[model samples]
Target: MSSESSKKRKPKVIRSDGAPAEGKRNRSDTEQEGKYYSEEAEVDLRDPGRDYELYKYTCQELQRLMAEIQDLKSRGGKDMAIEIEERRIQSCVHFMTLKKLNRLAHIRLKKGRDQTHEAKQKVDAYHLQLQNLLYEEGKYYSEEAEVDLRDPGRDYELYKYTCQELQRLMAEIQDLKSRGGKDMAIEIEERRIQSCVHFMTLKKLNRLAHIRLKKGRDQTHEAKQKVDAYHLQLQNLLYEVMHLQKEITKCLEFK
Candidate 1:
């Protein structure tokens, strides 16, 4: 019993010593893991002078990148505005050109209408002139026919008076020849001769009347010629007026 107790006690003492060594090994391993973790997670300690220099460099780089982005955005907005303005200007120019063309076409149409109206008025005026001329010509021809109708009756009366005067003259010449044969009847014959001389004077008066009748007939013929010439002149004037009216009518129709 004593020897068995000694063996058990000896194993216990050795186990106790091993326990101390194991505790020491575990403590060293824990320390090494803590050291490694601390080194891996450690924050850099700043040097005051170097810290300020690095901060300034980082701020400059950030400002440069921000300024470049802002410049690109500004340039893009300006380009877009310029393109929009150019399109607007082009549209306005095209609209103005179309408006001017429309105005010109309207003016041309108005001018054509005005010319047509003027031509119509001219034709109307010429037609009125032609009608007036024709009326005047008709009145002149009617007056000339009335004068010609009156002339024949006047010529017959003058011819009958000339024949009566010739018969009286022949009777006077026979009485004078009978008076010359009787000498003793001188006084009676002388009275008969005086009667005969009076008769001859009557015959000479009749001849003078016949000459006046011939002069009147010649004057009437000359008057008729003058009237004919006036009628021809009026007819020519009427022709000219009619021709002008025709030309004006044609122009109006064409318009």
Candidate 2:
């Protein structure tokens, strides 16, 4: 009956990978130790996926001191070093944030360069196709001319019509060449404008990232000052406790 009740009362357990498992109702001493180790593993912090998540995590670390501070106060204990260490961690958080921003900037810059290269490649491909088309057209004309030279008795009217068609094609080829040059120049200008815009946007992001970093540092500094004040207050309180104990001892002796 006791074993059944214990099993019913056991809560479900979750692993670090977030999988749920059945909790054991009873365990031997070794199994209990293994369970404690598993719990420790499950409690390990996971990697933060985003900058905001990392920032939130750091903020949580700072806020977590409230519980610790309360427990210390209840115990009449002073541990100011934890607050100081937290301040150092906050400073490192800002540095990591800056690195994240720099990494984003590098990624964006690389993307822009890749896009520009792809555009250039596409233009080159189009130019190559145009050149191939012009070559094929010229080959057709040369073949027609060779046929005409080999047979002078062929219809003069047909030969004249072919010449006219050849001239029209040549004019069209010249027009295409001019248009292609203009189109390529426009594409180049557009790419340059895009590059400039990306650069300006990256600069703006960097400025904003730094501004946030400064704000976080200022807040951390303020928190550090507050922590220092609290530490001093705790020290004063401890001194008072010591004085009161000394006075109590003297009174007991006098009695």
Q: Write the per-residue lDDT of candidate 2 for residues 36-141, one digit (tens) a residue.
A: 4332232122221343466666567656655665555566634666765576667567666656545654553464466567655666576568668878888433
Best prediction by TM-score:
2
When summed lDDT is taken over every stretch of 10 residues in candidate 1, the lowest stretch is 39-48
Runs off by more than 4 Å, candidate 2: 1-182
TM-scores of the models, in the given order? 0.29, 0.30
Give the winner by lDDT: 2
**Which residue pairs in model 1 clash with each other?**
none
Displacement of residue 13 (Cα, Å) in model 1 is 99
| Residues 132-244 of candidate 1: C-alpha lDDT, one tens digit per residue | 88788884333233444544455456455545654554454344333332332344334444434444444544555566667679999999999999999999999999999
Clashes of 1: 0
